[model samples]
Target: MKQWLHLSAVAVFLTLLSVFPVLAQEEDEIDLSQIMKAAEKKSLSGGGFLEFQPSLIGLNRDSFFYQLNFGDQGPKRVGQYDFRVRLEGSYEKRTVGLYFTGDGLLRKGFQGWDSRARLFEGYLSLRLNPRFTLDAGKKTTKWGKGYAWNPVAFVDRPKDPEDLLEALEGFYVVSADITRSFQGPLKTLAFTPVLLPVLENLNSSFGKPGHLNFAGKVYFLLWNTDIDFLFLTGESRTTRFGFDFSRNLKSNLEIHAEWAWLTDLERIETSQDGRLSTTVSDEMSALVGLRYLTASETNFIAEYYHNGAGFGQRESEAIFEQAKSPSAVPGSRTGNSADAVFPPLLGIPNPMRDYLYFRTSQKEPFDILYFTPEFTSIFNLDDGSCQLIPGLTYSPQTNLLMRLRGIFLVGSEHTEFGEKQSNYRVEFRVRYFF
Candidate 1:
């Protein structure tokens, strides 16, 4: 099956290559003036992508997550296929505009075929002036300075560390943006404020229902530095204050940082003997990162993250021990037991107290246009566990992309990465836009 998938991908690549010349030839015969006139008159536009991804996973049946999720019927290895379709459209009339984006996925895994559909983003906006705008409906406010992790993204959903660039589902909200341009050291200033309401069956996943939440961000471009001050308050979640900054130290080097403080943040811990406990206190999380580009077009990124809400090494070890034990019950465990406590602790991207992330990518090596190879690693500073990912991406033609990647988890028993279901995974993805 894996060989077939590889051959199929190769066939598609060749087909696209053959069609590219013909498409280019046809493009040269088009009238540029007519195209421009049509573009000026067209107010509605739509585009999206269809993606196919096949993966092979080497499972660790003895891992804590594997044991809890698959129980006694777990498989040692698995092959999975995924198909995804994303559609996005926008319509503009004068100062008013409407935008929507939706996606659907079909997957065949060890369990069987499964499907899901969701609206990722949908919003209406009114431009009051050149520097002011208002929007309402479901939207994503991607705020933060960190690349892999966003410690100060108080108003947005948590990012997937493995795929930090993937689009995420948005929350319902009303928001406004006001901007002002300056003439001196301060180049620009912007203010964004949002009101998010959580009611029955609407934005219920964000926090406690039946409450209104308020969040805002103040941005400034001063002395060649990008800075932001953020805040969130209300009944749905804990009130939080955040600050983030980004600046370029040189033409090829940049630095960024984020810090957030949450009031009355909750922390949960499990004991080695299967006992659980919870505490509430103010928490602080911070991240510092840098990006650099070398003369040879090689890009590098490194980050250090401190997760105040994450578990301690001892707590994580206790949870894993309980999960590996045969006497642990699956369904009857409560908040005070390790069986029920491991899910939330292990499900997060980085559930440990401290982490270090590094990534390097070489662009268009050997003069191969639109081709890149990258390597990334996330090290758990607390438990000495780590994940290594290496990938190659190629774009043979416009609006088409292909990527092949591998993931390897390394750790000892009772460590974070060692408790994952899959020790390694290999995947290939082909995506085409229309």
Candidate 2:
């Protein structure tokens, strides 16, 4: 039954692709404005992208992560191939709308071939009036103002620093949006409330099972500034409250910040002697950033983040020591659990106290149309480690894009970036949009 359903979905997707060009041609021959107006009331649109990436990675065999992952003996270099497909569509009929995004990936790596498929987002929305809307199903409520990091995104997954703008997989949720407009200093006001349930087979990765989480966000646009206050509370996780704001200082300069405070957050740490300890305390996380566009079309972004819940330098070094210990066992009581050590270090990127992010991108440099060059740096203030990335992007055609990039990790021993499994990597990617 599942196989038949999958095949039927593929057939429908192909039919939509085949129909789009015909509809485009017909619209070009008619009154486009009138057609557009009518189509807005009842429309179905679908599009997505295909991408291929090849990467060469240089291993850091002496690092703790390398030993934990590959054991004593590991390769010096690895070649990997990655292929991805995204299929997204939306259907709207008056006040009712349906939207979905599906992703599929195939990877050829040192471990051999692997493939996976996922529905990143599939949601149904209802607009009762111009000012109120409701949504149910899997959705991403991107509520933070930070670009590289969003400490205040209480209901959303953490963003990947390397791919900050990438679409994230969302959790099952029931949510609503209410908006109001004013004529005075406060021009706009909006509120969003979300209810998320975690069950044995649904949204299990979110937190503890059998709990319903409640979260909400209130927005205010006042005096040309955008501000938001948000909170989350439930049995699944600690209660937290946060706020974010964004403002344009000038035509070419903008600034944003996010702050979150978590009450009684639980943290686990490992001692150098391989003893595990847990702590519960109040914690705060914050990020402040700015974006500046120069006259030469060079865009610069800088951010500073302080993660009060993260491990300090000494704590991180102890964890590294535990991972490197030859006698470390998963189930041992005296020694730290191998399971606990690896997940905190590898699963969470930049699990340190302080960080600095800087990125600069030049658009169409030297009059080379559709070509851009960029550089990014993420520095760990606590451990004095950093990752540097330089890349170039070019769009040779309207539907195609090419990107080439190199990533290098720099740090001394016992530092965050220095102990990464990979010392450096180079990758080339090609993507096509439908």
Candidate 3:
């Protein structure tokens, strides 16, 4: 039954793509003035996307994460299906606006069926004037200028490096934005301040309960360069200060950098003998990146990131060795304790001290309109581990998209990627907006 459902979905996707050109041609003939009028008259608007994705993964039986997760009863290969729907709506009245977005997801894999639903963002905004606006409820700050990583996004949730553009869940906060424009070398300036409160059953995932967090950002557009200074402090987490800048060196080349200082951050480490230890110290993290576009319309982005809070090479090796020990039993008391200490170091995105990211994409290759083929790589400099992803995306018609991608993990023993549960994965995604 599951196989049949998968085949049916593929057939439907192919049918839609095959007939999209005809539908698009008809849409292009619609009168633009009428569409504009419709938009102008609408104060309430809603739209969302429905997605279907199927994935195949090849497992690595010798990997540490695999043993920790499915020690004895795991499969060598796994096939999975996922479905997701996202809905966003907005209502505007003169100076006040309300916006909400939510998503639901369902997945079936080697384990079983799993499903979840949550509100990604829902906020109310009041614009006092052209220069100032206040917002309340749940929202995402989306700070920083880096394409893959944002070291200075202190108030926003961390982005997944594997799918950097995917929307992330937001936090509950009250915030405000104030802006100023000028004609001199400083073209624009803006300030944003945010307050986040954590309590039981609300934002418990963020940090410790019963704490109010404060964060802010000041931005300046000076000499055609974008600069920002940001800070976050509260009892829920350690205090941090960050700075970031971005500028274009040439018509086709741009550069960006971010630096952050964390005060008295805490970390936990496990030894080869399964003993856990904790350490606290001040740390600094930084990232530098560049984007270049060639004459052929191929775009390239590369970045080097240093994560001060991540595990060192020796620390990672010890953890991997512990997993490989014959007496190690996942879910046992010892394993549970080790697991608690591992995520802060090993479970985060780019969970290593030093890493490199590179991506390139060609737009509309071979005169194929609305199509792009891209390749991305994230390399861990500390352990020589890396992930390579090659993908193709196509927009057959307005608000309709399709993507196919493959992920390959490469690493040696005791390396970051080498100990992952899967060595390779292939996935296909289709989404339709309405």
Candidate 4:
């Protein structure tokens, strides 16, 4: 049954590829800054454009059990998920472009995730003046120059998305680049999302207002390099402040690093140890990495994320219990189980602050609840052009990532039985535009 479904998906994908040319124009050079002149042409007529992308992939993993007091532990099989699909697009515009994006999985079985969605991007902009412009709606507000979240490579876009979304919502922003003329391309944008009545859910069937989100950015460009420094604050107990720096090395080699301080917990409480904490342990996070693409489109990347694991009271009693009575509780967990691909390093500190051999992974698409039109500004996210997800992508220009993929979850080793409960996902998509 799974194989049949996969085949059906492939057939649908092929059909879309066969008609891309008829439905959308290929990438063309359009001077957005000069569009006002184009508008003056009496023969002007509006025409739209589009870009479609698709990909497939497979994954598998298993966990192992170990006892520190006893000795060496044995490996245990744990998780796995297979199947794929990721879609993204942009429509033609005389000035600023219109865009949106969605990416996730097409699961093969219960172990596989059914699907995940992301609003990615949606918004509109018109340069109101040379130094400023008004932007409204959903859009990505980026900041910083780091890997845990910065725009850099491809295998997947080398940036994070969750942090990006928190930075751009119901957007209204103004920007200025005093250095653009003398120091090359550099800009600074300062703005905040519109303030409206707060509601319970931003993502809902009825569509109600959510919490207030405010953010700002300073973008610097020099010799093909991009640096985005940001500040963001939002409701739902969220506050993301970080920096993302990415350097494009000759269009083939790329590198990046990131650092964020997230300490806006709504409440505080004592843990089982009776230790009341005012601050979330290591509210700070960091990552660093590099990427290189060969002539054949083959790519290579090595990245790392240190989530600073100083969550006080994280001193687990599992190993202690196992030593006293391994049978008292089989495969006990003192540290709670979650995906290991992006494990949290909550307490580690960097005295030297050197960003070598340590960085965060764009291990997964940061969110699972997102839906928006393909041409809206809320969906141009590609993981590459995001602030938090560190990813790498590759395309020979022929395939255009038709071979790319979505999230990398499902199978991974688990020392506990609870992890086996990784549930299946559901997917449904309805799309149209005016």
Candidate-wise lDDT, in order: 0.90, 0.89, 0.89, 0.37
- RMSD of every prediction: 12.3, 13.3, 13.0, 17.8
The lowest-lDDT stretch of 10 consecutive residues in candidate 2 is 330-339
What's the true lDDT of residue 208 in model 2?
87
Can you write out model 4's per-residue Cα lDDT over 131-157, one digit (the tens) per residue?
Answer: 555554444444444433432110012
- Model 2: per-residue Cα lDDT over 30-93, one tens digit each: 6669878856643889999999999999999877667657766679999999999999999999
Candidate 1 lDDT, 224-250, residue by residue in tens: 999999999999999999899999999
Clashing pairs in model 3, backbone N/Cα/C closer than 3 A: none
lDDT of 3 by residue, 37-82 (tens): 8668567999999999999999988777777777767789999999
Better of 1 and 3 by lDDT: 1
Pairs clashing in candidate 1? none
Error of 4 at 191 (Å): 7.7
Off by more than 4 A, model 4 = 1-108, 111-120, 127-133, 140-181, 184-198, 203-210, 222-225, 238-240, 248-254, 264-282, 292-299, 309-434
TM-score of every candidate: 0.89, 0.88, 0.89, 0.43
| Worst ten in a row by lDDT for model 4 | 375-384
TM-score of 4: 0.43
